[model samples]
Target chain A: MAQSRNADGNGVPPVGGPGAVSLALTVNDITRTVRAEPRLTLAEALRGPLGLTGTKIACDRGACSACTVWLDGVPVCSCMILAIEVGQRRVTTIEGLAEGERLHPVQAAFVAHDAVQCGFCTPGMVMSCAALLAHTKQPSADAVTAAISGHLCRCGTYPHVIAATVAAGAETKGDGP
Target chain B: MNRFALAHARTIADAAARATTTVADAMTAARSNATRPASLIKAGGIDVLDLMKENLLAPDMLVSLRDVAGLDTITEAPDGGLRIGAMVTLGALAAHDMVRRRYPALAAALAGAASPQIRHVATLGGNLLQRPRCWYFRAAAFHCLRKGGGHCFAISGESQYHAIFDNRPCAIVHPSSAASVLVALDAAIELVDADDTIRRLPLASFFVAPGRDTERENDLRPREILTAILLPPPAAGLCTAYLRQGERSAFDWPLAEVAVALVRNEESLCVHAVIVLGAAAPVPYRAQAAEAALLGRRVDDNAARAAARAAMEGATPLPRNGYKLPLFEALVHRAIMAAVAETL
Candidate 1:
């Protein structure tokens, strides 16, 4: 029930109803405590209170995967999820995809393969690829497309997104896309 | 800023307490700003959140049935039926070995929605409860009959996307892909009332036609939470599949979709058949006339074509959607052929 001083800055009421939800969400093995309205979307909580803007919100609706994040090892649209609902679950955002500023393989491949354009959907594309790689060391070409199809890049980065996902999968096995 | 809220429901009673009022009450409250009434029922935020941002929905409070607990499991009943928790994600159900093998049609429907990300978040309960994807209903410009207006604009307006059957008052097609498939599979809905009382009804009975109530979509009352869906196991020797002919490969509503489940006897003659059409009416249009054609006949090419034609028998087309008749005819043929191929 402790207050966190209106952390999200949106000034919206709590999604959890009148009280600050006290909990810690594990982001990339780092425990960060949050005091937020239960209604706070995971995207807002991560980018606002936590100052991790790597998780972007393209459509705010679940349509675009620009707000993708890893929840309990599964890739999900962060904008559609409530922060309090996450509770003590593990949340790995695009910011958490790397190990100490060393670019995650997905992020690196995104650059090597020119998988990013306008950089709006890059963060989500990276996070989704990371999650796909975690579960699948070497996914088929269709698997890569399905993994990132939910994400939309208005700049027409779909080919690159697909390329990046395939590249990441290949990298997991020390091969090529 | 548009923000989504999640209200936790500790139990069915708690969830009902947090649910929106009657359809009339919800519309009034939503229009009146005192509450904005912008909340959603979160079983799977997959389709719900999309409608919200599209301005098709503006719920003020999201009742999170996720915490209602026990709503995410699939259990086998003594009657050899399957009871699926409302909170169970489509991915879970589609991937469940039993469902994939026993109810391949359901798995195909789930896999057709969006991508793995959506299938992972969309719940069976939410899938069945999703609103129609009619252009007139979703857009803010038109005051259609389904929106409680006097006339159904789709009857004459831009209705290539409207219903092809049950074209009386409203013409918007049923948008729940899973519901159509479930209906063909002969499932039932499990409901929990505001007073915590539970009830069950056949899945086919859950939807109401616009001819019956132009303003409402389903039979759900205010404060009634759809807790789970129970599918009586597929009939013996039954083969099922859902065929959706969409405008695109991803994230688009079906222009015309077909759900077919057939139970063939030892001699390869049909004993039971259920065919439901989506994007063809206000509710899932069960092609009873078409099903009747297959009652005793062997499902050959001629029988499949005749059944397909029978299903489209009473369709009254709008100006733009006249093409749907022939398109649906083709889809129905494909569905029947696929279902028939299973025996081979």
Candidate 2:
């Protein structure tokens, strides 16, 4: 039973009890450790200790796709998964999708297509589209629609989102910059 | 949400032991009318986290079963059936090639359920064991009969989403679309008790009606873990189909859903039939009368309509939910017709 100190220098309790424990996560290809309670969700841990505010948490429940994140290359609701249960899986947030100053194909296409309005659901929508493109190089319109079906764009950018994802999928296939 | 201890179980034995100890504590606490559960098992945490966030459930301890080995594989059983681990996510189940080829109804049900994000994380066992999505039971403000309260709020208020059959003292419909298809396929669930003893229960018998027990929805006892689900080998010339009519085309619970599995003879005459309706009753409502109507008869359009009429024979709908009767009848007709058409 190992214990870690919190940021405030408080003595954290050992793991497997009703106290905070140190959890190591591989986020954006970097191994970051944070001490948090067992009940904390992956979304909360990422936003709080990891400071990855790119993943939004509009609905704390699993209904909203605002907290979507890639867990082991699959898009899952981070708000529904426990931080402690993430164990050794790779986590990719919206902030990790871009390389340096350049944007991922999905993000660039989103901007080009003007798919974002309020921008609250952009991160999640981008992550989902990126995951779809990571698997399918040339996704059809229906495929892109099905991929982002869980996400709710209150700004009603659905048509543009579909166009951007389809265009990004084709761009990825063509190896375009 | 309330603060509670968390226990990570690395083995199924360890999880059962922890659950057994906690169930005893929970039983003792129940004597004092404690609202909090003594312990809960978290597989995927989709439903558990929602209940916790809504303050509907407070557990003293959470026994996490994610680290348990051999709980996430889908394999072929010795009898040519499929053995799906309890922890296999809904997305994986729907996308599995074997499931798509052999159990298309189950795949369709899974694909239509919840959303892409939820299906990626929600496991089969958790989906089957999850609580009802009734507004009254989900909200902390409404102490419905399922929550150990004296009265059922849905009976008198907002009965549109409530059950239309077998809803006595409680009106919440069973929310698992997968379970309805599984029941039609005659699936069996494997359970591991705290003593390491294994038990198998037919999927149809797993859900308990409100008349039998108001506090719980299923037959799962304390200190028991649903380890796997076993699907029997497909019968000869068997054809299955699932159809759900939701309010929305995507990411919405079914207003009325039906799954039909029928085995036809070489001449295209029905030999056996099973029709299970979901979100229409407190349990997966088996249309036995409808099945009888299709026995030994050619499953033509006229016969399908007749069976559908028989399926709605004894449905006691609430004042607000009578619309479900016609809706369910239409689904039943479509499901049977589609299943019969598949045989051709």
Candidate 3:
């Protein structure tokens, strides 16, 4: 069994003890390194040290998709993942959706379809929809619904969200926007 | 969530070694101290993180198996079966063309699970080993029997979502929808112990009954890692289907779920059948009486109804969950009919 040791080869405290470890991650195409406790979640690390507050934490648990992010091109609940486990994977949050001032197709479509009501679940929904459109250029209504099924919108903006995702999927198949 | 140390295991051996060492150190420390810290293995962290946030589990060390290599591959076995690694995510399993074409029941169960984001992150092994979502057990206020308390609160308290069958001292239903389909498909689990010795356990004997062991829901020992799940080759003329009834259409636990795998003979008579029910018991309940009812019988309304009725022969449901009996019957009947329809 491997024992916990510091960089100088000194015996450190057992795992889960009060000790800070250095974590390096590539978030939104920038390499970032931060020292945090082992218990720090990716969502906490992103919002706290990385200053990427676009990924919101609603339920904190995996039940809600409020803290959704793209890990290695797949959508995952950032709140459920430990910061240390992220390692060298590419992390994409809600703030990374656009290229600059211009909004992503899904983001633009959400605004066009009036899908944002409370604006709490918008980031996670956009991330999920963006990931879906990244893989499927022309997704059906059912596909769009399945992509964001885990998300909870108290304002009941599901119909608009589905319409926005499908429209964005269609837009991706066309010319540059 | 409590403060815990984290250790990333690079290999299966490393993960087992770290878990064993951590558990041993915790035990040694407990001998001299009043508190006994625990160690837990995290694969997907979907369920573990929830339990930790709820204050249900507070481990001293979390052995992360995420960096472990070769534990995420799903390969076809030499005997024409499928060998799925423990770390395979539900989304990948659901989207695999082989799984969709060959084992439609398993595919349906995977697709109908938690949500798209959850399926993308939740691994197959972690999903099977997830703790019960029973409100009494989840809330730290209630010290139920499963938490090593004296009594079970769900027995006399609110049990609308509790188990209706195989619920004795505890009433929490099995939370895994994949378990019922796996049991119907006759899958086996491969476990690697702390000593690095591997053992294969039949899926039927994996989950323990509630009364048999209130402390643990499964037979997996501490520091033992579930490495892979082995599925047998599909039988000829076999057709399978899965059906679940939940309060919401998505992101909700099933109230009653059923999986049926039926093999028909040349004359359209049932040759073999396995009917498994979920959310109705503490463990996945295999309806032996129902399977027997379908033997040598045509896949018609009468046979389906007979099998469905036989499934709940000795079910003793609680006051609130009595509706589950009929729900199980209907689901089982529908699942069997769906499977039969697939053959046609």
Candidate 4:
């Protein structure tokens, strides 16, 4: 195998390792170094070595959005991305969705609206809904449904999820004043 | 997934050098009829990672294009043609103002594909070159022909979601929703070889039919990289639409899909038409007969039905999937009507 070589002056392209390499990932605004293989997924790394297990792995594939997280503030499947490939992008999981002691508006709304049945799909659901509220504060019911469309809640919490997301968007302030 | 060496290529040249070694290993393995692990290139790692986890492909090395510069932008040419880099995500492509206004069909195609998370992660290059999501091919126990095995399990097994037109060799339907719209827009693609040689050809030629070769879906090899997509300038009086039906409303594979592009003369007669079907066959199936049937005719309900009928001329549906025949015909009619409705 070709080792990490700085062939040109392009500033260290192949910087990781074939075995376990230390990665300085800026997850949730804090930089932490974790030793992992190139094949370890971001979700696996986040759950195992980092000990941040809020991001649940249901399907372990792209079929279910139970593993959704924020890559540079946009929602993406954490299970689908390799931890090493994340490079310099900021990662935000469910653990980073709130501030100090205040729950995120979507999280509060989920509690108020009884949106957690099995609670397996709640973390990723909250991430997608919170991302939607950040963009559109007064999102329509259809928009809320579209926001969490990728999420598969076998607990049949879709109606409550939509209602909670809609109320969360309405309660919170949007991008503009 | 097996442990593989990962290389983050800072430049395209760096990637090209790695591709040469990968292609060498691939050719050697192919010649020996051995199931040896070879090197591969991946950017988003959306579908490739899935393939790897399923034990379908175990690469020895992975040249990551995650941070490759100059391949993630969308630029408009001096002649108003659009040049989209391969690394552009579906979400970015659909949200572009130029794409939404000039090519509504393409915008629709990109919007209707996958989910919000997938759209943000999976690139357009990976979408076009993605492998078919066949049950037999995906399962390790089947050992289908696409994996260089003996038989196609879908032929005698559960084939409800299989192909209707091309049912002899393999029953797996192509899964790209944007490909049909791109073909309707007459897009071209750029592919870079291992020697850093760039070749641009029509996007239509990029696909390989199951009858031609059941082993591979597209012409891309593990060593080649799909670089860019070039969309020709929007035609005068061009109106287009893409419509698809899936089992579920969101984040689902297309059950029946159609993309229709047409140019109408001042007399309300169709002068040009292009109809392509997605998830219908092993390739983006072009309905040449349907296009010919609509030329120089008024795009009324009668004409639309006739053209849709013409589109299903050679369909040979399997026993379990004969429902797709009517589904495709109705989708074609709706797609044409949708495009015509946009004109008003």
Best-fitting candidate, measured by TM-score?
Answer: 4
Candidate 3 per-residue C-alpha lDDT over B1-344 given as tens digits, one digit per residue, 9 for 90 to 100:
77777866766766776554322122222222335446668899888778778776667778888877888999999999999999999999999988999999999999999988889889999988888889988898887788767788987888889988878888988999999999999999999975779989898898888778776778876668899999999999989999999999888999999999999989998999999999988899989999999999998988999999999998878878889888999989999989998985
Q: What does DockQ come to for candidate 2?
A: 0.45
Task: Report the lDDT tens digits of candidate 1 across residue range B1-344.
Answer: 24445665677877776676533234432233543463445666666556555665556566777766798999987788888998889889988888887888888888888666777788888777777777777776766666655666777788888888887877788878888899998899899986889889998887888768776678887678888899896677888879998877776778988999998888888999999998888888899989998989999999999998998888888888899999998999889999999864
lDDT agreement of model 3 with the native:
0.85
Off by over 4 Å in 1: A1-15, A18-23, A174-177, B1-6, B20-25, B28-41, B46-61
Give interface RMSD for all predictions. 6.3, 5.0, 3.7, 1.8
- Residue-level lDDT tens digits of model 1 in A1-177: 223333243323234543556668778778988887665778889998889888898778777888888888788888988777786778888776666878888888889889877999888888777777777777776877778778888899878777777877776784321
Clash count in backbone of candidate 2: 0
Range of the 10 consecutive residues with the lowest summed lDDT in candidate 1 chain B: B23-32
lDDT of 4 by residue, B212-312 (tens): 87777777754577889999998898989999988988788988899999999999999999999887888889999999999999999999999999999
Q: Which stretches of candidate 4 lie over 4 Å from their true place?
A: A2-15, A175-177, B20-37
Writing each residue's lDDT as its tens digit, candidate 2 over B141-174 gives 8766776678898888889988888877898899
Ranking by DockQ: 4, 3, 2, 1
CA deviation > 4 Å runs, candidate 3: A1-18, A174-177, B20-36
TM-score, prediction 3: 0.94
Place model 2 in a CAPRI quality band: acceptable
Q: In model 3, what are the clashing residue pairs, if there are any? A: A15-B5, A16-B4, A16-B5
Sliding window of 10 residues with minimal summed lDDT for model 3 chain B: B23-32
